[model samples]
Target chain A: MLISSIYKIPIVILLLSGSLFFLGLYPDISTIIGGVALFLIGMEYMEGGFKAFSGSFLEKILEKFTNTTPKAISTGFFTTALVQSSSLVSIIIISFLSAELISLTSAVGVIFGSNIGTTTTAWLVSLFGLKIKISIYAMPMIIVGIFIPMFLKESSWKGIASILIGLGIIFLGIGYMKEGFEILKEGIDLAQYAMSGYAGIFTYVLVGIIATIVIQSSSATMAIIITALATGQIEYTNALALAIGANLGTTVTAVLAALKSNENGKRLAVAHFIFNMTTGIIAIVFIYQLAELVDYIAMIIGIGIKNYTLKLALFHTIFNVIGVIVVSPFIGTLVAFLNKLFVSKKQSKGKSKYLDDSALGLPSTALSAVIMETKHLYENAFGIIARGLNLKKKNILSSMDLDDVVADLYTSDTIDIDDFYNYWIKGIYGEIIDFSTKAQINMAPEYAEELYKLKLANRDIVEAIKGTKHLQKNLLKYTSGRNRYIKEQYDDIRKSLAKLLRNIHTISTSNEEDVIILLLSKSKIHAERDDIIANGTLDRLIRKGLINNQMATSLMNDSDYAYRISQNLIAMAEVLFIDIDSDLKKLHVDMGISDEEAKSIVQKKDHS
Target chain B: MSIKKFIESVKASLNLNKFEQKGKKKAIKRLLQKLESRKEILAKIHKKKLKKKDLKELREEQEIVDLQIKKGKKLLDELDG
Candidate 1:
């Protein structure tokens, strides 16, 4: 608490102190300050304008393109270059990571590309702003940008105008900073204070970091360094060190963005930090070699040796390219290392495994995810139902005869169905429903119908489990009692359910759909025949005096529960497993009997 | 009768005592009505000569209904035994 309170001292005081220090050092401090303010404002407008213009389309493109590492890297590079802000790209990558749209490795790849993308600003400033009187162009651009937005009706066109204005203001800000640096050069040459060793590199690097932290933009700091270099206010060596510092400093944006995100987001942010810092270290270590290479490359391309600003741009590009080359081979190891560094919190067993916010945007993917999660729910329900019937799941799923398994178990263990429902089924079931509902919006009608059927199938599975719970009480009582007839009847219920489960397991694993349909149809008929009400089994048992009124009543009720369990399970299986085949679905529609009709046929035959 | 006995009689007369039996009867009635409709559909399909494309569909439907009827008769024997 004490530390927090002490840290809460206003940041404005620090800013004021820094401004006063700069004011004492340079007479044109106001120009520099105004330039910085305008540059930051331009960055904000550019970010907002790009986001408004692209909307969700950029996200769709990101998702679609980021299938592999190389593609992800290129996508990241182009996106950041277009937006003119690596920080915006970094934040978007973090959001994508949080949503599970992109893997951590892919996100790291994008972050690497963004570092290179950010160098575009340095090239733009050196090639245009330093050589020409860019403020003249800036004035007309701002005028046209303002007028264009007013004439345009569409918000996206207005956003484009805002971007144009932002770019113009950014150039104008660079011009102001260059003018201020030129005046400061006459009064004081900061190059005189520049030392000639690693100390100088370290000091200048620290300055670069502080400037970027204050400005919240590495691109702006790079522009400043380039302008100072062009005016001979700072040495080339110090400028190189400053560029490295700016690279390291940009990770603060990702870290801040990841603060409100999930573990995956945090992992991506840390990966960004690691990539930049590693690249910065490598650049610093080989700074002289890199500068010599940049000069050679520039000469080969027919550039003058005296053009330090252009040489700086070449250095920026070369060092980042070297970073990508060095880091690309180690990505797998890096991903492994990152995975260990930011270990995710272990999810509770109740959470849905496949349903994530990212999948909701893609209709087909979301449908498959829901199906996977529902299958997970079914597995849990299967366990509950198996335990409730006092049969082992392994035996039920295996080739062992269910009748033998039920007969072998003389005593039925009591199961707490409510506890099972609460622990496993309820949370995931609710999530699947919620996810499917959200996924259904903006989807094609047929896909929406598919999702609706999946929802019903999930409901049926839960209902089957509930039916098992209802049957469990009487099943335990009658199976363990001395009444042979009731015991045999309850065992029959258990055997039938086990067989149904075994059939489903077989159909799930097998590839033959026709055989599965036939088996399912036969099982459906068997389930209807096994019901005591339509079959008059309860009435005959009552008349024969094999059981008393109370016992008969319990048996009849429990039999209905068992029959409903089987019916629901079969219905759920039909929807989940068989409905995927369009041809079979059409065939079934033409040929299959409705549930009501099936039940009625049984009732009519019993009456006859 | 005494007051408690009189209240019990009132409850029994209200069909509260035989609620399970009442529920069973209602279910059976619904099932019987559904079977009658299905039987009528089957008879109509048999009476009209179906097109070549629909003949296989009619045959498949008849097969499913036959399976239901066969299963239902076995259940009837078990119930009426």
Candidate 2:
């Protein structure tokens, strides 16, 4: 509750207060803070731009490319490099993992590649930006970027323009940070504060982590470290430690993002944290040896020893590469370990199993996911209905005669239908409706229609449960009593409904389209013909003095409930289990007998 | 065999003629056919060999057959006396 209240404070207000505090403490470093903010915002814009331009397309590509470990790694590396934000890639991967679009092993592979891909920023800053007056180009790029997006009405063009503008702002941010650091060199020599050996590396690593966490962007932290190192504002060893810290800090973003996600998301987040922390520890342990290796590699590449910024980039790349190489072979084992560490809890009532935010953007996947979840809802409702009718689920689903199963049965224990609905049906049903609402955006008409039908099917399942809940009250009262006629009448209702459920189960499990359709139609007909009110069973019972007026009233209401439960279940089956195309559905609608006709046929039989 | 007796024999073989014992034999025959057809459709659906349109048509056909079987049984029960 406290944490939630803390989040309730608008982010803008938090940013304002945080900025105020920093401004008061380090008036001279205010520019650096502003630069960091701009850099982070720039990263957001770029991520948004990429998502807006190629969100669905990229998701498709991600699904296609992540078939194997090596492919997943390269895809991750390339996507992060393209977007210039490993956090973005990680979030996307987390979303995909939650959606079950990728395996845990493949998601872990992507995390490894993202770590390697993040090194591209360090390389870009060291080899290119520091070598030239990048701000000169940043100014024109920003102007052009703004103008192009403003003039263009197309979303795709606007997305491209946003990308250009984001890049320009990033370059501009780097220029400000570099200038601020240079000014700080004259005001205070941070080099004097830097401790000498392992202690210095440890302290600098901690500083790096804090800075990256504060900024929420490891790339921004890397830029600041590289810039400070270039101007001799910090020692080389400390900068390397800071680089390791930055790598570790990036996992914080993923951890926070996965907080509300499903179990898969949580597992992926833990895997990322472990990978980054282990790699950071390895870097710290072998700092000197790694430094020597970097020096040797720089010499071979003709980079001067004094070019510490590029050499720092080289170290960043090497350590991450080493981490990937060491960890790649054990990805399967790592996934298993992660699975054990974070065992998925049995699905409690109310949580959705298949509706993830990632699938919302993809129409077909969204449809299938909702269908699967609706089926889950039906299963829960099925359990409720079985208990409501005082029948065992196993027996109803078994090959045993439903009549025999329901015949000798008296009410054993009264189930709290309200409690069951609250636990199992309400939450998941709401989530499916919410997810479908979100998914309907930008969907093709046919897919939208499919979603609409799925939503209706979910409604029918819930309604069936509600109907069962209504029936349970008197169902318990009469079924367990000694009144032979009332008990028999109620038992008849139970048997009829149980038979419908059994037939639905059979149809759902059966693969033969012909059989499923036949069973579904049969269930529908039985539901229609078996109506107690239409058959005048209650009237006959009352007239014959077999049941009292009070008993007849209860029987009539409970009978209606039974009829609705059967009707809703059959309708749900039609929408969920039947895998017919739109054309055939239309044809079936056109040619098939209506419910009214079926009712009339029953009436005609009575008249005859 | 006369034409009427021959027709009676064929109807008896098909289990569609006798009403005195109710439609029990006819109901059983329809039930068995419906169950068999259901099995075949389920097999095709499992194999993923059936086209979507054909599957829809088959399912509808199955439903009609099921309704027929159900109504036949109900009618037979009503005629049991």
Candidate 3:
């Protein structure tokens, strides 16, 4: 309810806008909204068409070009610039990264590129293109975007539809904005006093930033700026300032994204912030120069680029491209600076939160960020598992309670391992799984498998984390008993588990496919160690007079169940490397006894 | 198409040259074999006049195999092209 009430503030502002328009105070409302809608829709349509046309090529380019930070940043920047929105680029990169389909560094570069990419919108708006009543263009785009799906069987056409509809919405908004501004021009005196103070420029700048932050769109902010300029309330100088502020303001996404990210996230945010800040300051230093440049170019070309709106947009483009050229070479230095600047505080160490819900729509990018976060968690899990095994106390053996260990093993551990199931994975997997029930729907079966592999991987990690937790609980109980061999056995198992977890960490974090397969193999070794734990614990129990005949039988049952759970999780990991049938057969046959048998094996051992 | 022939059609198209790497080719082949055998087993179970409960598992397996084949084929096409 609290969050809902807060959201109402924006809705209320939009409503009051209508009443203000009736009073003829805020001009260009219709054209502003219409242009925005058209621009957004056009951008979306163009992006989808381009992506569909170039998905494979893009993937390859991403694969080849995303090797270094600068390259990645430039790739992301250029891609978004070509397409006109960084959000889409961010979304694509995030999903690929989250899927472990791409490297983290590449994903980070894409995130930075997305910021530069979005600047294109401001430039586009400043071109005064939205003012031209591109309704003729809009009609054809709408028709193609809307009807292409009916004609084409490919799913990419649907993506095309989204772009087209997005353009339609943008144009519709621009048209509305134009009407709102015209009404204001005829009746409102509010315009004359609107810029009464020098402070108004700064206020407009801040307002531009705040509006973009609220809408999560810099293009929309630029559109509103254009509206102001067209209405005569705001001068070109003030509008230019607002445009600069909007560029800096849009960097908030990367900053918030980096808030709890690892070193890579912080680097991306810093790169974006520096890039925008540098451009903004440069633009200010040469505002008049830039104005003259646009005027001179227009005069030379004889195209009457006298439209302040068009000049502003041109300045935006030239400024950012120039800024990128100047700073891209120093991407490495900037990244290092950010790492030093935003070091995680000592008090809150090892808690890297990632893949916030804010990133969901950009599922790929969100997933990428979460993968980085998950890698952190996987490493921690590895450490815990290792620490559990190597705990050395001679008296730790004396505290051994084989009976309780056996009993608890029969029942599953109570710890919530789902913490390892990051939100991006869940959101993506959930969508795919939900899509499975669409009986008559034609869908890419590969889509489902992609989702399945992700789900399985996350599920595997959760189970492994739980396994470590279970091992820790029982090891603690046994080690405190002053049983030397039990203590040593516990320590050995801890070391192996830790090693296994570390291997998983390396595999999960690295984009290298071979490394991932190697990690899967290493995880499989945990199954063998688990067996050793069973046999060793049984031997230790027999030596301590702890295992009576009945206890021996129960111990066997406990081993079976524990083995099954561990294998189940391990199979999930191997699924990424191996096919389902082999994985399933391996789990059911080669790994150990059956799942049901394993469950009862631990129970029978506890009873014996 | 019958699940068996559908699988065979997918398998016959599994040209290794079409794959970019040995790993991918092997992966495709292994998955195809699994689907082929799983489908055969499921069909046999169905022909045996198995009860609904016994058939339930076969149904899931059949669906999975079907999915696996399609996915593999699509992947192969994308890589090859």
Candidate 4:
């Protein structure tokens, strides 16, 4: 459809150019320029259309299967071969990968696969475009395609029709381009100059790289080289060198993409660069031998070596195939070495402070980074909660030991906890709250309500941690087993705390948050559990003789902390449900604790 | 390996490709139920006063149940993929 739309400009230029030819009127330089413009646009339109239509399914298949590194590489090569253009496949794969819709190792495989797949084009050009008659079938293909859309009802069928029509148009465009070149073929001395006087192998190779980079089509570069070869303007040796350069230069897009990505993207790009470089170097070292190999194959197959264009294309295909097969076993080692070389020191160390600011321009890519970062942060928080909860279970000798352990955990790791607390957590919650409130005001209630609940849950987690410093410093001091009941209360709370922490640790990865919320909502049960321990401690205090009022009060302080932690957690659950009014105070109130009671406890001293 | 074989391996890794979707879903549900039942039995056994030999047997049973759940989940993930 895109080609058909863009074909309008080209058709007009082609008509004018054709009229000049038939009327014996020599077309001006402008008409030649117009023809070139149309040719490029048609090629691009068809290529872009094919790319978009197949990209989604390709991504899905690659993502579903590429579990291991080897699997990833193999999938990459096969899929690219199926698609026909490594450049086209690479662009799609990189975009999906950058968006984290696919894994890093799999992207590497696809890169390898695309390199091998792209070689198929040169082989097709060499075998069929040179040997077979495409012109007869080309006309029929156009006719069938132009008429198919009239009968198709399904949207997908129409899309397929568009692709078929696009294919027909592509061939027709190629025919016109060739004919246009022929019309002016005899008039140009520039062709002879290009072959011998003006340029050599070095120049031709440079031209190939520049042409591929600019036209963004190595096939077009090959066609141009073939046209030169067909017209006897360039020697076979030089043409072969240009083909090698074109392969190296076609990797420009992957390299540029890496500039805007993290280490993984850079690593994939480096792998592509190394693959091309390795093959290019090998071909250069044994240029004549490889050329002779292509010649031998052509002669054995009875294709005959008359067409220099065909032979050059054959050489291009053969070299890539041989290179891939030879390097397949060592591809992993090459990728690792290249990754180590190209990936920055910081990135290798896993401290990628660089956010690929370029990602901000692309919302999908930025959103992917944000989701990954958020998941990381969530996992970190879960870790801390796990450690803190497990303290109650561990038989730590002193409050100091528990405090030292928790403090050490917080201090370690490269993440800036202050930034994590102030920016990510607060920033995410702030946006959610603002959006929810604004949406509610505008009467877009459902999403707003959801956001509101999430805000409450997040805020409650912060509140749960608010009194942690005091608890960590004092809780273990109550372990004077002199009063058997107090010591037992300590052990029981510790065990329950451990169990609570364990549940929380697994909860985030859990398939259903329903279980977590159910567990959290049993806040009243937690309160009962705390009371049983407290009552047991009081009975022991009365029985075990070493009891004082101060000791009794310290035991009460521990009970209050348990009550408060459970209340905050319950608030978090209600908040998750989007219960807007479920604050810390409201939760405490629901747990039958007054504001004064909570305040008085916060001010209470450490009996230890 | 040939590219074709590699692609076949990839296709084979997906859980949905291995079993009928309905059967796979039923299997997951059954496994989850079995796991829950096993946990309840272990918890009950842990709280009871028992012979030392019986306690050791219960511990072994717990290990076996844990392994069963892990193996089942691994296959489930492969199927889901």
Residue range with the least summed lDDT across 10 consecutive positions in model 1 chain A = A1-10
Write one digit per residue (lDDT tens) for candidate 2, span A1-608: 00111222343244445556778777548666666666666666676577556555566667789889998888878887777766556656666766667888888888788778889999999987788978788778778778664444345556677787888888887887788788888889888887879988888888888876666667878999998898889989999999998888777755775687567767877877878888898999999999999999999999899999999999999999888887788899889998897787686756888778755534556676788789888888888888887888888888896668896453488988899889888999999999999988976566788789888889899888889889889888888899999988888888889888888888778765445656666676667777888888878988899988899889889888888888788778878887533222432342234587567656755676
Tens-digit lDDT track for model 3 on A1-608? Answer: 00111232453356345445644533445444434444444544555555444444455566578888778878877777776656556545544543446665466566656656666765555454455774446667677777655544345556667667656656656656656666657766345655524476567667767866665557767777776676675777777778877887777745765565444445555666777778777766676677677677766755365577776776666677667677766666765676587674442224344433323433233333444444444444443333333332221222433233222232223333344334223443333333323311332343344444555565665566555545555555544547565555454454444344444445434553323433454355445546644446677777778646554554454355445545755565454433222323232222222334333434444465
Clashing pairs in 1: A536-B79
lDDT of model 3, residue A497? 40
**All candidates: DockQ:** 0.02, 0.07, 0.04, 0.04
Residue A229, candidate 3: alpha-carbon lDDT:
78
Preferred candidate (TM-score higher): 1 or 3:
1
TM-score of chain B of 4: 0.64
Candidates sorted on lDDT, descending = 2, 1, 3, 4
Give the poorly placed runs of model 2, Cα more than 4 Å off.
Answer: A1-28, A139-158, A251-262, A300-304, A348-351, A356-427, A434-608, B1-81
lDDT of model number 4: 0.53
- DockQ-wise, the better of 1 and 3 is 3
Interface RMSD of 1: 20.3
lDDT of 1: 0.74
> TM-score for all predictions?
0.55, 0.58, 0.53, 0.53
How would you class the docking of model 1? incorrect
Error of 1 at A195 (Å): 2.9
Which candidate, 2 or 4, would have the higher lDDT against the true structure?
Answer: 2
Tens digits of per-residue lDDT for model 1 on A4-41?
11111233245335545777666476566556556666
lDDT of 4 by residue, A187-272 (tens): 76345645442246567667777866654556656665665565555567778878987886666645754675556556767777
